[model samples]
Target: MDDLMKQLHAVLAVDKIDHNTVVKSVERNPYRRLLQEVLLERKDIIRSRMNLVALYETEEPSSEIEEILAQFENPTFPLEEINTEKEVEWQPLERKYLDGVSKIKEETTMKQTQLEKDLAKSLAHSEEVLKKHRDFRPVDDRDFSNVKQSITKHFEQAKTNLRGDAATKILVLRREIEQQGRKRRNFDKNTTDTLQNWFHDHRTNPYPSDQEKAELAKQCNIKISQVNNWFGNQRIRSKQQAIRMEEEEQKRLAALAAEESEAMQTALAAASTVATSSNLAAASLMTLPLVNPTMHAMVLPGMPQNLLAGTAGFLPQTNYFPTAGQMALADNGNGQPFYTDFENFGLATQPDSEQFNNYLG
Candidate 1:
């Protein structure tokens, strides 16, 4: 990536000089031409975004380019021999060549900064839609799309700048975005593949067998408990979901059955409107408002079922099965008939005959 960027910058710088030749006399040129302007603008945006990285290149590389430009002033090496390290390294020639290169590099860097500022200002003034698109770009490329558009416009407006180093550098930025995107895709694919294989192996009876567990520990480079706990949690979550589904199904079925049974019972009750003694007594007992059935069922330990069955025959027709309130007040069973000494026990008084009849029915 770095090598490609250097090559790209070198191309842009060369084209910028050619562009300068077309538009202005070397003696009176006030500003750079199209390629120069574009390359300068790109450099500024890159400098700001990669400021930390730029410190090394901007300072060190500029110094080196300046040293090279100094050699141009004194012909320390013949023009044809400028590319050779041998003559260029000798005392007088070396210093001159170094200075010449340094100046050239500095001039190019300055040109880059100017172009960046121009691009940045244009983009900052552009439409909100363009601004939004720029914001979604990566940290390095946040200003790229807008910058590219501005460079294109500048070139069309200024013919001399049309075919220079700036165009080449812009292409470099695009290649950078592509390369980064490809790397990111590969990383995501690898992560997904690892996760998929892990889950596939664990899907059935997800709890790991001892051998599988050891292998997983080695593969993940983790403790056995970590793998064990993760599988345990996943299994528990799956079980809870299954149980909730089953409960929902059971409740649905029970609701359906209850609705049908209620309809049948409503019909049966209508047919038995003429209530009999047993029916009336049972209805009376059922109607009595009690706190809890377990307490009611405990009232007489070892109490014969036949006693409850026989109570219907003993109840007087006029009384409609003695009110439970009356029975409660009857006695506290210390050799007393429950009915005769009702006032002595701490119990409620009996209901009226009308309430007793309603309860019986």
Candidate 2:
């Protein structure tokens, strides 16, 4: 029994050593593991391919697949024997295809390079344009705005001042025109003489009619309004002169009446004395010589006929009465005299008949 047990132990120990050696050799061998992995991957690929074929076979086949199968079954050309030399030979079509591909790649590379250069140039040009704009641009926009506002304000003020000045000038010119209008126009000497003559001719009705005024204005070379004014003034002045003359005549008559009354009283006393002392017949004859009836008949021969006729009842003595023309001439060429020196001239109780006739005519 001991020999048999020893032999069994040796055999089991040898078998264990051989198993460990085989495991170690397998772990160290690179080709052996690669072979095993390749075999396992190949088995999995075959299983996936069989599953796909089964799935495709279960469904209906497409026309494209049937056409492909027909192409394989009835090829136009027989299978050619591949010559190793012909497989490596350069064909014209293959060379052309290769050249075309190479040319297209070269063109694409050139275009890409040109595009990069153009992009760089565009970027540079854009930067330059931006710089120039910045250089020419206004530094402060607010300053420009303020300047524009100031200019507008100045123009507005200038326009306002100009308008105001124009208005003021217009007002000043209008005032000057009004002042010129207010000034009176001086008439000529001829106009004055014409007006005076007409006034004397129409003394009875001094107010002229419209037609008469027009005629006078035409003759005098003056306006009708001026003629009317002249007539009005002449009428007023002549009336004042008439009043003055009447007052002077009244004073002279009163003085003459007082003198006549004194002379009568003296004569009466003398006559009474003469009658008592001397003969009554001589006293009566002396009184008759004192009262001469022909004394009033005395007149100057050189007196104007018109003056003589007008003074027939008032002042019959031409020596005591001057002609009306002389009285009119005494007035310095204005219209009429305001007062007459009747007392100094011994003109008493005489109406200016010649002047009245001339004025009426």
Candidate 3:
């Protein structure tokens, strides 16, 4: 009996109404006709099942049997009469068989298991279908060649359902496309040359005038606001780069000054200690007093021979101590040191004296 029911169910399921098939009929609820057509097509099998169901409940021919016989004799039959008998016969029997608490629980558990299994299968099938769709790269060239065709495909479904308004939408979209295309082509042609010239001419200082920006807008067929914004961004970028370069120059000068100062301090300290010890050494040698001839040859023309000989001879005389100013001058190679001027003026004077004078003024 269960096998027979399964066979019957399969037959009923196979008699499907294609959900995608389009039918242009006046009636909107076309499923009524669809069900009738399926039933008519499988009339012989359905009639046999109805008879068996009736006989299983009661071992006799009922009013349902009489109705089934009448339907076969007359081709034109109402579904209402057949449905009425089937509902009355099946309702009591299903309720009576599945009434107990245990029976209800068993049936519910069985149904839930079946539903879970079906859901898992459906989810897997959906994932597989989605994977195929995701992997599929369209080989159809017409898909992208014309923009309007793609838009129409995406939006203009259900031709029968669409009223008069769709034509207006397509017309408006086309006009917008043409206007935008014209604006872009004009902008591209003029913008490149204008920007290149502006950047080149203003390499030293790149601030643009309002009049220049307006002229750019006219040439490019764009708004003045767009040119203004581009120049504003360029100015900010240029300023940041200038600031970075100035900072790097400052660090380099500071390092050079530090190295020079350390070397000068070391030389000054060594010269001071040598002068202090030479006085004691010269006093002890006074008992064997002698004049050196090489000392006379040290005096030469165009050289500070007197200053150098005096500094060397004075080191042996304990009574002769030069002033702090003279000591500083000696370390400075007998000329005003570059650092002294820097200390006074806070920077090295430039080599161009006229420019330095002008800057000072």
Candidate 4:
């Protein structure tokens, strides 16, 4: 049964989709029909055993009742209704009947065990039949749900039995097929690229009109839902990326501005230090006495160099005499000195005798 389920699952995985066309009539797999009959016969056997169990409390064993009981007890029993497989896994019915207040429950328990064993054998046969003839079971009167409800009523823990296991596999396959049927189909790369081009062209208004979406769907070999889903995801992601880029740009600009500001501050600090030192030097010079080298060089020829150096600062600008180096009384290297009235070797207090005396010196 497990092996057969694997085979069926493989088939389902390959055929992910089923056509949606419906018909009033269609040929079903005869093997599945046979399995259905087997289930129905099992149901009837259950009804018969229940009646036989009730009848056992009053009457003795009858041939018909005994015949019905033999089918459940032995899988190899010859049957006139259908060809049964002789190769069946047979399990003996083991029970420890206690001194119970209700023997009917015990009787029912035995009946359930008998039914469970036979149902497993029937399922094993069905599995074999499925290996060759498994096809899509259309939704109809012969639905597995009816079989599930009928069989599960007989067992307290149906999930542990083979009937439950087969039914579970079938239902799961049906669900998978239905879900795959409703799933959104994928498009090729060209189709997605076309959609991307449209999205970019309409960046200011990416939301497509209904008619535009319909046109796109037709052009792209996709459905409207696929178009809508793609556009929605694309718009959100594009905005998110744009916002990230803007944030990164802002951060870059801020870092650059901070660097420029720091450099400017450093340059200003160095320039301010230089300016402060220059101002201090200028301030120290402001308190010193002044002197003129040109005035000292313009001393009278008779005056000593030391005397001129000492008194040149007190001499008025227009009243000065040549130094000894300019004198022609001895052999001077330069031409003869031209002593104007202001450059005479005399004091500015000259009047007559005293001035003449000063001039003579």
Candidate 5:
């Protein structure tokens, strides 16, 4: 017990030592210092219990003792020596743990930095896209609300009007619709006649210009569109009629050409027959005898009287006429007969001057 009190007194005296001196002492003998601290703590607990027992014996107010006991009941840890052999062994392990933790923290920080950079880039791209979209947007936005409002108001007015006068309004609407839907207009007789005459006059180029249409409409007391439609229908009908007429004319020309060809053929055949008959008569006249014994001799009007008196002796005698065999021999390859050996007759010789002069006379 005396040794324990001395250790407690030494522990208490440690508080009076300079901080540097105590740290040096603890460093020199850390295990011994830890043993002294633990012994001091035991001595304090023992002292506190002894005081409580004395207060219980006296039966005096034990509030202070109870407080002291309560304080002692709380658990307290002994001061550990920082430079002991066990703590020296755990130093390297603690340093390795700190190094691992620092390494992990650095990796997490690097990952966080990279993630921040990527997020920043994505935000910048998004901003650029939004800016481009804003630039491309239309300068003026169209508003259809006014048109919608007008249409709604019109429908409301129409409904109100319809509710007020249902039957008469319906009749008027029907009449208006009928008028609007009417495709063909009924023109007066005079207007129709005038239009027909104009169409006939300009049948080749039936299309009318805007000015002509306007004039016709004014004259007819109608709209220009009506005049245009009338002219359009008239042109189509006239073209169809013209095509039909042209086809008929072509057919008539073909028929006339055929009739002319037939007439030409008939005239050619008649001319050929007349030419053949004339040729046959010429052949028969050439075949006739120059002198006929049975026929009476007729004197020519221009013959001399002396030649006419000698004409009997100049004529061929009936016996001197060629026989059928001699005639056949005299015929050349041509149809005309040719006489040979005419020089055998002395009459073929040149006549004397007296005879020739008599024949000429």
Candidate 6:
């Protein structure tokens, strides 16, 4: 039936308690009761190394304890604020923690008041006695011990936050390093273009000096090794290309010369044929009168029609006839050596040797 109360785990000294006057603190602030469960001695956490700020900050806010958190968020009263040196037990609480889950009724009762008095006396004497004999701090004064512990804890927290920030920064730097590695392996676009332009510009002597290579690497944001490799490969490729082009050019010239030679041989053969045909035609024309004035052509009866007839369409040789026949044995179809009247088939006059030679020429 007393289950509405939620536990409070102290984040810092005075995170739970209100004042050094235990009677007033327990009576007025029932929810601010301190317990031993959160102390280093009671904690089961590893090494008992506590980080209170981290613990409290990470915990989900309890709607049941909204009133307590609100005061913690924005305090108005002195008691609403975290306990300071003014509180009798602030020193002991600053060094440790507080855990409590007492029912609201129990916290408000006289029994809780007596317990708070006893707790305030333990580890911390009566505040009146401290001020009278032990030189207790003034109400407005700060405890150097509390201040030192706070600075130390905050510095540690800041260190942890800074470490997280450092982790993120390292990841970004790692990505950039990877990007640079890729650029080194596969040359960047700007560097490629720059190198190509340089190569073409200095085609006569594409080599670069050490200083020039250094400048190129600086401008391209790349490594010297990459630049060196590019030039070496380009030179080799250019040489191979030049050799291939020369071979191709030679092949092209040889093909042209071969074509020209073949054409000349064809022309010479044509001219030879024409000259032979012209000489045969000339011989045929010279003998035509001896054969017959009216005849255009004569193919011998026993000869094949395939005789070289391309001499002015047909040729007649005067050697076919016999000379000096008076009374010819004239069998017309019996292989006869016949003689004809001077107007018809007659003895052929032999051409003069000098005239024949000159005519043939």
Which residues of candidate 4, in runs, are more than 4 Å off? 1-187, 278-361
Candidate 3, residues 145-209, lDDT tens digits: the string is 22223222222222211212222333343344334333233337458678657966997877668
Candidate 2 clashes: the total is: 0
TM, every model: 0.21, 0.28, 0.25, 0.29, 0.27, 0.27
Arranged by TM-score, best first: 4, 2, 6, 5, 3, 1
In candidate 6, the residue pairs with backbone N, CA or C atoms under 3 Å apart (3 or more residues apart, or in different chains) clash, namely 20-88
Candidate 4 TM-score, true structure as reference: 0.29
RMSD of 1: 25.3
lDDT per residue for candidate 1 within 1-361, as digits (tens), equals 3453354346436434243332333224333353344434445544443433333343222343344334335433332333344433345534544454455445655776676676566556443333432222222253345345544445233322322333333334334433433322222454335434776676775656788778766766666776676567667877898899999999999998677456435433532432322132223322322212221223222323322222221121222233444443222225442221112111123334354344334
TM-score (C-alpha, index-matched) for candidate 1: 0.21
**Candidate 2 C-alpha lDDT tens digits along 291-334:** 22211122111323333332222322222233443342222124
Q: Which lDDT values do the candidates have, in the order given?
A: 0.42, 0.44, 0.39, 0.45, 0.44, 0.43
Q: Which of candidates 1 and 3 is the stronger one according to TM-score?
A: 3
Model 6, span 1-361: residue lDDT tens: 0221222123223333333443333234433223222223223221112454454464343343444433223422322153343455443332221111122223333443554455444324323322321121132223323333443444444444433433343334434433432322576689889999989999999999999999888988878888898899999999999999999999999999677556544544543442333232222222333343212123122222222122232223355244553333233334544432321322234223354333323
- lDDT-sorted candidate list, best first: 4, 2, 5, 6, 1, 3
Please give the range of 10 consecutive residues that has the lowest summed lDDT in model 3: 338-347
Q: List the candidate 3 regions with Cα displacement exceeding 4 Å.
A: 1-193, 199-209, 218-223, 278-361
Which run of 10 residues does model 4 get worst, by summed lDDT? 90-99
- 1 or 3, which is superior by lDDT? 1
Candidate 4 structure quality by residue, lDDT tens digits, 1-361: 3453344444334333233321111123335455444334434534533543444354333344334333233422222123223223211111111112123334545666787787676545434433322333344334333334434443323322433333343334434433433334577898989999999899999999999999999999888998999999999999999999999999999999677556544544543442333221222111212223332232222434333332333333232234542332211224433322323322332224343234335
